[model samples]
Target: MTTTSTPAPPRIALHRDRLLPAEPATRGIARELYAAVRDLPIVSPHGHVPAQWLADDVPFPDPTALLITPDHYLTRLLHARGVPLADLGVGVADPTSAQSRAAFRLLCRHWPVFRGTPVKLWLEQVLVEVLGVDLVPSDDTADDLYDAIAERVADRGFRPRALYDRFGIDVLATTDDPCDDLAHHAALRDDPGWHGRVVPTFRPDRYLEAGLPGWADRVDALGEAAGVDTGSLAGWVDAMERRRAHFAEHGAVSADHGHRDAVMAPLDAAEGERLYARARAGHATPAEAETLRRGLLFEMARMSADDGLVMTLHPGVSRDHHAPSRERLGTDIGADIPVAAEFTEALRPVLHAFGTHPRFRLVVFTIDETTFSRELAPLAGFYPSLYVGAPWWFLDAPDAMDRYRAAVTETAGFAKTSGFVDDTRAYLSIPARHDASRRADAAYLARLVADHRLTLDEAHETARDLVTTIPREAFRL
Candidate 1:
């Protein structure tokens, strides 16, 4: 068979009214609302970007490394299409020039795989808006686009700190392990030349998971980091508290909890001590470890209530669904899948204790949309300390975001929602992700205005608050 490839577009253009309402009257309102918040400063409370990137201020290595490799959203979809993770530079520490170019070609050739996905939208924005690429991504234009992006990233203007400023980020929070010294965060804060606010979020998931391997050793490490003894359960709690204080001293505003579920029932002190002793001795049964893990989650919430760090909970993920893939490539290779989440009963224990506490603040996130209206909104509707987190993980797409707004807003309303969170490791896509969210919110709010549920002025104010005040209040930024 003889065939000719179609030529790529000369210039890729993004629509100005993208993600807005379809009807003319509603579209007009959405445009206005979107315009009001399109350029607002982003306040990212929860994300996976490393603080070292900003502290070091290094130029991105290459197009594939910067854009393709680090983004699991792109890689996972490509992997589903029978592409090896290595082809996309997933496990390569430093992919060679040839390898990089080859990976870029693979992405371009498979451009159709991303059609109608948020990954496509974010990549488009990153390429055209951020990196100044002209031609659409395709096999024919891969090398040209790669060269263009490479030239741009090589420029000093594209360094991490410079891009942070250009992205108009008011504050960016990075997730960090409990044992992390946060030296990079300290360096960024203490640097006289830097004025940007980059804070660390205390993520103690691994330490709290008593069921995992090396759980006992992780406890020792935490104790060593906190300069405390972990020979007893009291010392373990003391060590965690000390580390939390250390993070707070370095400008942490939130504590992140990611468990298999949202269960937070606390165990009595004697039972907790018994379980801790068994786990520390490597003799605790799986069931005992799980009970201890749930108790640890409650302890974390109790600590948050005492220390004033906003507690952010995102649960119900069956991480590393494919064991062989995890064994070969490692965790977070887009193998983590969401499971059904229950919040009402699961969170009743913690909510009962701290639901009315003045110092406690809780932001709940989920990948299960079923819980939005059925559980999350109703829960946040009553608890003064609770705020419904934005659509997260698998649900961060354009349509999912619109659905999220519709599902939660009826019960909890706009003020009770936690605004948008990018929750990304792809640093360059931050603005694009936030922009997409703003557009989705605008579309949803515009429909309300068109239906006379809200006035245009009220919608405008809501659009502004969604970008600014809501996140600030939710995360106590």
Candidate 2:
């Protein structure tokens, strides 16, 4: 059998009419506001795209792998609508039998399902504005779109580094395991041709608790990586310090934690040491696990203070909804569900210890919108070290973003909040997601200006800060 290369598709044009704002008065305001910050450099302070992709500079495989298979947002929604995961080449399904091209066609066929969805908006923006394909992707145009994208993937311009430059990214951060070698980051820092700033963010969920299935093995690996013994509590702390220093050497500016809830327990040194020993022995009870996790969190916060790494907490997730999937996929396969989170009371201990310190920075994220006005905004408003994180996970859409600003901005103001952070694993959607955020922010500001709440000039300045300045300052980029 023989396969031939496909030809490139014609460029898609984004006219001035496609811009948001339909009202005559607000339309001009929106356009002017967008113009002031549309081309500002993107500072992506938090994300999950690995640095290896940029360091090695490899071409992405295909539409199935790039778009359909890996994107939980795409597959999970499709699965919810009765489309089997196998059809999308997810799980342990056989890709050859599934027909990867047909999966792409099916996604395009069902593209209308995403109509008011953030996925649809991001896809349209990327298709029309970034990828330069004007035609709407549907059953009629699926094959053509797939072939065009595939052809581009084989081109040098579509490589990760090229896309990084074309996207106008000033700095990009990838989330990394505490036990990671970070060799790829070192390679990128040494390469002169690849000048784009790619950094790492420390994520220490695995090492902090022992309830996870493979904690013993993970601890041993951490010990080997950091040149410390894994048998003792003090040694484990030393190993963490070593790994943190390694991450810092590779340009890490922040540390990220995703806890079950915003709970913390302040334990004395002896108690913490005893709990750590029990956890390492795989004999930790539920209460012990919770206490140890919280204790390590406080330790992580203290380590951030000592090392100058900004601490970011993404709490309130109930991971692993499907036990079978958890057994098969391990974790983070779109099964995580959000629950109620308490910011004020749960974080009181940690906040009381470090909130007044000027050098300590803590960014708090939540899935509970109910906490925005009542708790989070108020907490961020008062604490010198606290900043509210951007609308996260399920809340990163246009409506949610606007609601966030409305809920918190009056009380906390713009400075108390961190700017947009695309916490996505899908690499291609980075520019699209950021573009949607920029437009949504501009639209919101336009409304404010039209309402006489803020002047057009002030809105323009605020737009620039939200897109560029705030993220840099908040994450220490």
Candidate 3:
């Protein structure tokens, strides 16, 4: 007779209590504080969740599609660890026809790769809190976790609107292109049964770039969307104005721009008109393209002042860093790479023109961490119209968040910052990311309280600000 081996028991609890303060007195205080604010509603003022998900109210297809396909954060990290993109069902490959189960099993096998990383923490939280799954997912339990998740996702309760309500999200903002018609947004607004507040953010990257190969066609689309002829400089400007008005009618309170650099060049009307003609004719030289883009950015600032839409600029990303990948998959598919950015000098033209103006509000973001104190904080400290955006992209993790506060708070202070924006395409990870941010912030504040630098009362208030007040006020939620 042969004896069978016994499997180890899976960890069932979140372990948050131990992961947080452990000293008896400190633990009691943290538990009490966390209890009071643990259930506060989430305010997501900036993100990339598709509105159609809510409008259509359809169940997500499968484990791979639901969790793996749309999350670039997960895919990029896995790729960094020598995992091929095709194995994760990423790139332009057909995930639906491929062996999704095998791919998901591979991810589950490599779950340990996420240990000590933010992704692991967030996934654990989502699993334990959101799905109520206690068993740790590994190769041993991969099939069980996948089947459970897929089953729950097939239910109507897991649809976008239901999850939005269940998650207690107070406000959600969805980013949209300049040429978008926003029909789904209108549908949501008109639906009496849906009470969730989902708003649109105007992102005009395609329209702003004059050097793109298809700029003329994109301009024509913008004109058609706005019902204005964009053949002339004046007409193109009018088209942009019309589109902004349309976006405002859809409850848009912010306009976002993702550019290669934050440099702003203010051109006189004649110069602007000349550059516009070149761009319209598809004959613009590199210098002319730069001049036109800068001119348009200045005009966008003026429009924001007039329309009361907060302007957010994300710069220094060298888009399509992998040329072959871009040729195969187009933009925003994990090809964007960060570069060193200059804020003080690059933004001088726009700042000098409108930085002190009360009507204008500009929030700037950088992937370069070195500039946080040296450039961003100082600029935000002085410019009334400028505020430093939260640590973005690769810097959204826990340690980076801590470094951001440690570096910027001394100079820019809390008031000069715009709080946090999740900026995610993964809808399920929202709460997890925010939870990590809150914990990291609380830990930082606890240190301040411990060192006598701040009172506990002040730390509590600051925690609330970082979570709720700042995003609401900064994004006009």
TM-score of each: 0.98, 0.94, 0.94
In candidate 1, the residue pairs with backbone N, CA or C atoms under 3 Å apart (3 or more residues apart, or in different chains) clash, namely none
> Candidate 3, residues 189-257: lDDT per residue as tens digits?
999899998999999988879998899899999999989998877788898888889999999989999
In angstroms, give how far residue 409 of model 2 lies from its true place: 0.6
Best by TM-score: 1
Residues 1-477, candidate 2: write the lDDT tens digits.
999978554344555634367898887888888778888887899998889999888898786777767778777787777777667777754576238898898887787678678887676767766666776777778888888888878889988999899899899999999878889998998898878899999998988767776787888899999998977777877888889999999899999999898876678889988987888788899888888888888888888878879999989989878888777655677778999998888989888888887678999998898899999999989998999999978999878988999999988999888999988888888888887788878888999999999987899889999987788889888
Residue 440 CA displacement from its true place in model 1, Å: 0.5
The numbered model that scores best in lDDT is 1
- Report residue 133 deviation for candidate 2 (angstroms): 2.3
Which pairs of residues collide in candidate 2?
Answer: 12-132
Error of 1 at 397 (Å): 1.0
Q: Which regions of candidate 3 deviate over 4 angstroms?
A: 18-33, 91-94
